[model samples]
Target: MRFISEQRFDNGCLEREFTLGDIPGILWTPSSSPSPLILLGHPGGMNTMYPRLASRARRCAQNGIAAATIELPGRGERPRSAGAERARADLRRALAAGEPVDEIVDRLVIPLVDRAVPEWRSALDALLSLPDVRGPVGYSGGLIALGIRLAVIEPRIAAAGLFAGSFVPRCMFHEARRITIPLHVLLQWDDEANDRQSALDLFDAFGSREKTLHANMGGHMGVPEFAGDDAARFFARHLT
Candidate 1:
């Protein structure tokens, strides 16, 4: 990891930005001591610097936990391609039309996950190499597909807090069955962009004996502040 810049907040939290090869990322560490790390995954169209992600990192730091996030494929400073743009457009159209998106998801979302999951693993390796980060790692946020894949494959992640307000491809259901880590899933009861049944199905598909679903009645962005607090407590219990 190559250090790019850093800023220290008045609360004694240190935030640093870096690049792992070509991937841009940020790490937040509390002032007192080394803490367990959480790998935050941003919502679609957002980067590591998205306010929610940054706020979550700060919240984790306040709770004596370190956090890190990397920009997903086709995001941040990564090079964009015409094929990616077209795939995104097709996904949007498919979602808006309420059509079967299996083909589009297979073509687009799977490839994105294929590239992203390994990068997340690589980022985990680099983040943990830092002096102030410890083991018993956790993962939080979305895109849900990437979260599902990571939960299935990344043994380093002891727990996961996933947002279930995105489109779920059929294959992801199978992947969810393989996720045996402790899971805390958040779902919006009336999320405009997501199929409620699909989200419920995905949550039910998780094979973790310790999985919990926190469903709230609101739109896609209606996850309240307390929801984050609850997730933090969950991570504290598992990661710490």
Candidate 2:
């Protein structure tokens, strides 16, 4: 990984912007060394997601855990995917007609998982090579389907904190059944954009014996601060 820029948070956490191959990413390391790592996940768009991501990174730093995230394929400054764009247009039309979007959701989410998972694994390879980042890894945040695939395929990720606020392909339910690591899932009860029953069912599908669901009353962006604290504790329990 090539480090292009660096800065420090007021709390003494170090933030570095870097690139892995063509993918742009950011890494946050706390002032403390030998920190466990958390890989942050989000729905596409790095620029739009930065403020919240920075907040999450600061919290990870406070807890003495390193954190990092990469731009997903076809997001931000990356080349656009015309096929995904077409699938999105199809999704909008299907939604407009009150039609089931199973196929569209599959089309949109599956390929993203396929492409993004490898990039994250590659990022993991590079991040863990650094002296400051060590111990077990945890994954936290949205695009729950991608998180599921990563948790299943990437053995280094010891736990996960999933945000139930994204479209999940049905196939990922089977993949979810393969995940045996600890999981902490946060569901926004009244999220206008998410399917509540599907989120609950997906949670139930996880094969992890140690999974916990925190269903709170809010819109997608309105997760209570205490829930985040709870997730941090969960990671601390498993990763530290």
| Candidate 2 lDDT over residue span 97-187, tens digit each | 8899999999998998899999999999999999999958999989888899999998899999999999999988999999999999999
**How high is the lDDT of residue 230 in model 1?**
92
Model 1's lDDT to the true fold?
0.85
- lDDT values of the candidates? 0.85, 0.93
TM-score of 2: 0.97
TM-scores of all predicted structures: 0.95, 0.97
Which residue pairs does candidate 2 place in steric collision? Answer: none
Highest lDDT against the true fold, candidate = 2
Per-model tally of clashing residue pairs: 0, 0
Worst 10 residues of 1 by lDDT: 41-50
RMSD of model 2, in Å? 1.0
CA error at residue 58 for candidate 2, angstroms: 0.5
Name the candidate that leads on TM-score.
Answer: 2
